[model samples]
Target: MRIAALLGASGATGQKLLPLLLDDPRYDKIITLGRRATGLRHRKLEDRVVDFENLAAGFDGLKVDDCYCTFGTTIKIAGSEAAMTRIDHDFVLAFAKAALAAGATRFAYLSAANADSRSPVFYARLKGRTEEALKTLDFADLGIYRPGMIVAERTDRRWAESLLFPALPLLDKVMIGGLAKFRSIPVETLAAAIAAFSMQRGCGTRIHHWQDMVTA
Candidate 1:
């Protein structure tokens, strides 16, 4: 049995993943740390509202076997690039550090496809840097999931995404070989993949691209 910690249990991906984690027999406990309550009740689930800016103080002494980080935001939603980075980069790293301090040995992070630290794109670069930062923590197992164009019903709507979602399947058919990693994936698939990976006992770091996630 394992005790699992989730950092973004209120988001779309997190919402999908939470039920899977709850049903999985491998995890005996699931602790959710978020700004707001997950509004979920389960015998194995423990929901804790937290201040992301002061995670160490709020979450001190909290320990778990595995930690899943699904927290993220867009520049538009965050109001500016700096704010986006605060959530995507600063908060994520802080959460990882806190989780590590609290005895988490395995970590699973949600990153975007083509996350290059050297990339000029702000989002990609920030995600890449976050990934790089996570590597330095030296967890027993670290899984970075880089999925592209997740298909799901989001609470916060983006017009561009809504318009482009319909064409994703057509685009996916042509995105073969080297471009396979760009193909859109269902949110459920991604959630299952992360859950499966988190339950595994392993060592070293693994990056799961689109192909790996869909197959998992």
Candidate 2:
């Protein structure tokens, strides 16, 4: 039996993940922390409202075996680079630290494809930086999932997704070898893979791309 703490339960992928975790027999309890409630109830689920800016205070005393984070935001929604960084980078690392202190030995983070710390792109760089920062926490196992186009119905749909999704099938055919990581994937598949990998004892850090997630 395991105790799992998850952040970002209200997001697309996280919403999918919450039910899976609740249904999985491996987890004895599931704790979800966020700025607001998930409005979800399960026998094994415990939702807590936490201060994203000061996670440690709100997250204290909640011990778990594993912690998974799916928290993310775009620069447009966040309104500024600093604001995006606060949500995507600062808050994520803060949660990892809090979870670690609370006796969590495993941590899982939802990053994105092309997340190179030295990348010229701001979003990729931020994700890469967060991945790097997570490694320093000394979790027994760290799973970083870098998914490409997450295929999901979104309430706040992006124009780019609308433009790109139709072309995704053709792009997937041509995108082979090194570029396969960027291929589009269903959010349900992605969520299942993230849940499976995080629940296991893998040891050290493992980075999952499209092939990694689908194949696993």
Candidate 3:
């Protein structure tokens, strides 16, 4: 049996991912530390609400074998680039730091498809910076899932995303080889893929995309 820690268990993808780990016989325990409770119960789950600004007390003396990070937000919803980075980048790195200190060896992070640290796009750069920061930690395995637009019924859905979601299937058909990574993926599939990646133990950093997740 193994122990796992999950951050952002309240989010769309994370919410779906939580049950997979809880039901899987391999993971004897699933610890979730987040700003809000996931509101779901499982025999294997231990959910805790904590302040992201101060995680030291929350993770004190905790030990987890693997950690999953699926928390993220948008610039529009955050109201500014700084706020967005605060949640997506700063908070993410903070969790990685706390998890590492708590003896986590494997870390799985959910990132954007075209994240580039040097990109002019704020969202992509934030994701890229977070990914880079996570690598500096001492995790033996770092799984960075760079999934494209996630398709799901979100309560806080963006106008643009709602308009574009209907066309994603048509767009996906034409997104052949190089563009395959950018194809929109369903939230359920993304969650399953992340869970699959978390189940594997290995060394070095690995990045996954649409094809990889679908096949996982």
Candidate 4:
């Protein structure tokens, strides 16, 4: 089988996933696209440095079996709500359009746990809108993963999550249902699940919640 693309090949989860994709025999060719070059040197790896918002032209010649999107940003680093939405929602939608035009077989997205298009929170609202847009694409296999508080060692995560980690133990005790026991999952675990689920055939549009990942 031939593997097509990795959209966020430089981010936290994407970094861990790169090695696994390189080592896996299922994919003969791996194409990657991001704002900056990944500087990843491999026989099967083709890295493209371009703006995700304007990927339609850049994606003209690309074809892949699956498009894995682990791309995300925070409001702090993004400087403003508009910028964050641009990267997190607009950019992702652009990539999805390109992928569909290229006739990709599947689209895998990394969305947060509390995503809701009608949510009061702006971040979650954007994620929800993006998820809704992806559903409209009608890909044969559409997988959305909602991971909560991914714990990656030596990651470049924003300071907010870092500050919240210390309180997790106490929070877990008092929190209930999905909010309670909101255990921080490791990045490797999330990436492994993405790889495993992406390989399976015949799965339609499905959303995997936080507990599903913990149990899977």
Q: Pick the candidate with the highest lDDT.
A: 2
TM-score of candidate 3 relative to the true fold: 0.96
TM-score of each: 0.96, 0.97, 0.96, 0.90
Query: In candidate 1, what are the lDDT values of residues 93-129, reduced to their tens digit?
Result: 9988988888888999999998999999988999999
Per-model CA lDDT versus the true structure: 0.89, 0.89, 0.88, 0.81
Output the better candidate (3/4) by lDDT. Answer: 3
Stretches of candidate 4 off by over 4 Å are 154-156, 173-176
Predicted candidate 4 versus true structure: per-residue lDDT over 126-190, tens digit per residue: 99999998998868998899987888765566687789878866765666686733567789988
lDDT of 2 by residue, 95-192 (tens): 99988888999998999998989999999999999999998888989999999999999988788999999999999999999999999999999999
Q: What residue pairs are clashing in model 4?
A: 175-180
Regions of candidate 2 where Cα sits further than 4 Å from its true position: none
Tell me the deviation in Å of residue 129 in model 4. Answer: 0.8
Model 3 C-alpha RMSD to native: 1.1
Better of 1 and 2 by lDDT: 2
How much lDDT does candidate 2 score?
0.89
lDDT (0-100) at residue 9 of candidate 1?
Answer: 88
